[model samples]
Target: MNTQNAEMDVESLQKRRRGCFLDAFLVGSVMFLFAAVTTLAVVGVMTVKDVESRLKPPSWTSESGPLKLTDVSSSAVFTNFAYLEATTSGLKNATMQWAVQQTSVGHNFQYDRTNHWMMPVQSGNYFMYVNLNFTCTHICPSGDFTIHVGEGVVDKLSCKVHLPKLQDSTAVIKKCWTVSSVASKQKLISHMTVPKEGLDNWSLDMGLGMFLVD
Candidate 1:
């Protein structure tokens, strides 16, 4: 009878140990699964943010760049100047980038790099001038380079510069137009085109200057 009792006690001890081990294993597995799910959620959120940023248009500052608001007490708001330099090798048109901001900017005007244009936040009469210089290694045969203060609109101002048939020469052109009147949200930007014949081995410099007259 004593032997039988001892055997029974040993069996119970073994069963209890197995149960404790099984419980520990189950708990560890659950923790691993929870950690994996949390990690995947974080990764998914990061990927969504990246995709949204890529879908957005390329902008230098904001919906618009550089605020246009100046105090009327001073004349600084009426004075402004912007310039850029670009070189083209192919026959394609090269759009000027306002990389350099020189001179005073008024509260009524704003500059946007994404569109490469200087726009007026408030409408008023403004005296606008555009200057273009093109230097080419070879002479142009057909068309002359055209420079404009405002291009592709009804009130656009333009100047055509004749390229002399001489290699290693520079053609200089300048034009001034009184934006006699501009409605609110109107833009006055500078644009120029280089002839396909003289695009090779050439450098072009463009500048736009404006002052509020009214």
Candidate 2:
């Protein structure tokens, strides 16, 4: 009976030793896996930082920074006028004419057409267009029609349309100008031109249009 007890005790000791070894192996494997994951995470962060440092402007940045420029702040406004009667007789060169009426569509914009000079009140980029149509007694000589815009006498922008030789019919002149970097307080005015003979019949459809852009 004493020998039998000794053998059972030896078997129990061997089983405990095997269990301890298995536990140690499992713990070591878990530790190694955790270390590898941590190293990979650190290397990935460093690589991203290095790539960001070498980047240049005009590219997207992931780091928290000022939002890139956008056109959301841009705005547009414009006003125009037209004449119902002939404002001038024998018109050959540039001249400013006031409108007796204003178009209802453009009154709410930035343009303030007190009379002939429908100038802009807000300062920004603006697109200005003018169309002057007329009638004549005889065939009118082909000439250039110009829309002159500026402060006082300095013509900053001029849009011109050529009138081919046509008489006893209709003559049309048009001009368009895209102005940039303008001051709000700067004095602005505009004028138009047509053939001398066509001036008497230049009574209808004489209109101007403008739009402001950011």
Candidate 3:
């Protein structure tokens, strides 16, 4: 009888041990599944963000447009000047306007019309840069412009402008003198003073210098 009782106790203990092991294995499997699910969720979110970025245009590109520079110089001593204009092409549903001023010097300036602008004219050469943002509601118009400057030594002026296109992050830099148009979007306009020596060599890619816009 004693032997029987002992055998029964041993069997019970063995059964309990097996049950514990099975429970532990089930818990481990559940934990592994949870971890896998979490990892997949994170990857999915990252993929969505990447897709969004790919769909959106870059800031520099989205904020630029067709750029033109007009040299208005008189045959006088240190009385040459220039102005810049940027227009939108194909961009629809946007209102576009821009203003430029010499950050270093003061001068009279105008936009959209003539005879209603003023700025303090300062000595020495200066750069008047403009930035524009707009949204059109009706028809998109081709970008066009004229830059005006007071009588001064209008040395060489360089323009660096970019316009962004939808579905791409990179901006298309309107090659200097090459005309570009946008029908509906924001555009960027930048003007800088060109060095006298660099202006002499128009063929070299100064990356930013004067070029004739035909």
Candidate 4:
């Protein structure tokens, strides 16, 4: 009887040890699984945040690039432009000396109201334009009218107008050109030539200017 009791006690003790070992293993596995899941979630969150940050648009600043104005002010408007105006009464020797209607000195651009020239103080690109309007008081014959831009020695741009019939009417001629890498202190003067005689019979009104493009 004593031996049987001792054997039973030993069996119970072995079963308890087995149960403890299994419980310890299950707890350890659960803890390891939790740690692994937490690590994966943290990594995924960090990766998503990184991608979001990368996909976001870059902020613009004055140091980054040119300013973008929703409503541009007058001062922000083109400060490097000149617009000269003239009439036939002011034309001399077929060269029109225009008065400065609107002009601002910026981007190294200037106009000589005295010499009738658009002068640039820097060597760069410019947008030059001219507008000529002609009207005949009595009659205009079929002929060509030409506009030359530059000093009398050389021409930068030449524009021509043709009248197909003799009529007492008006004609408007406009031309624009882009000049690249103009020299500093370069002069641009304008001259008009009418194909017919009798300058007194025709009237001419003109506008011209040069604006720095870059």
lDDT of 1: 0.56
Q: Quote model 3's TM-score.
A: 0.31
- Model 2 sits at a Cα RMSD from the real structure of 21.8
User: Model 3 over residues 1-214: C-alpha lDDT tens digits?
Assistant: 9999999999999999999999999999999999999999999999989855532322211134422122112123212223333332322222222232211111222233232222323233233322323233233222322222222333122233322223322223233222222111111223233322222111111121111121
lDDT string, candidate 4, 1-214, tens digits: 9999999999999999999999999999999999999999999999989855432322324565543322111343445555556744422247777664232334455766677777777766766666666676566555666778876578776777765554566654445454655678888788877644534455666666566678
Clashing pairs in 4: none
Give candidate 1 misplaced runs (Cα > 4 Å): 1-92, 138-142, 170-176, 195-198
Superposed model 3: Cα runs more than 4 Å off: 61-214
Compared with the true structure, model 1 gives a TM-score of 0.51
**lDDT of each candidate versus the true structure:** 0.56, 0.52, 0.33, 0.62
Q: Comparing 2 and 3 by TM-score, which wins?
A: 2
Which wins on lDDT, candidate 3 or candidate 4?
4
Q: Pick the candidate with the highest TM-score.
A: 4
What is the C-alpha lDDT profile of model 2 across 140-181, one tens digit per residue?
A: 666666667777777656777666666566645443445545
Ranking according to TM-score, highest score first? 4, 1, 2, 3
List, residue by residue over 115-202, the lDDT tens digit for candidate 1. 8776766666765655555556565444566655563555456666665565656554444444556556666565557675554555
Lowest-scoring 10 consecutive residues by lDDT in candidate 3? Answer: 201-210
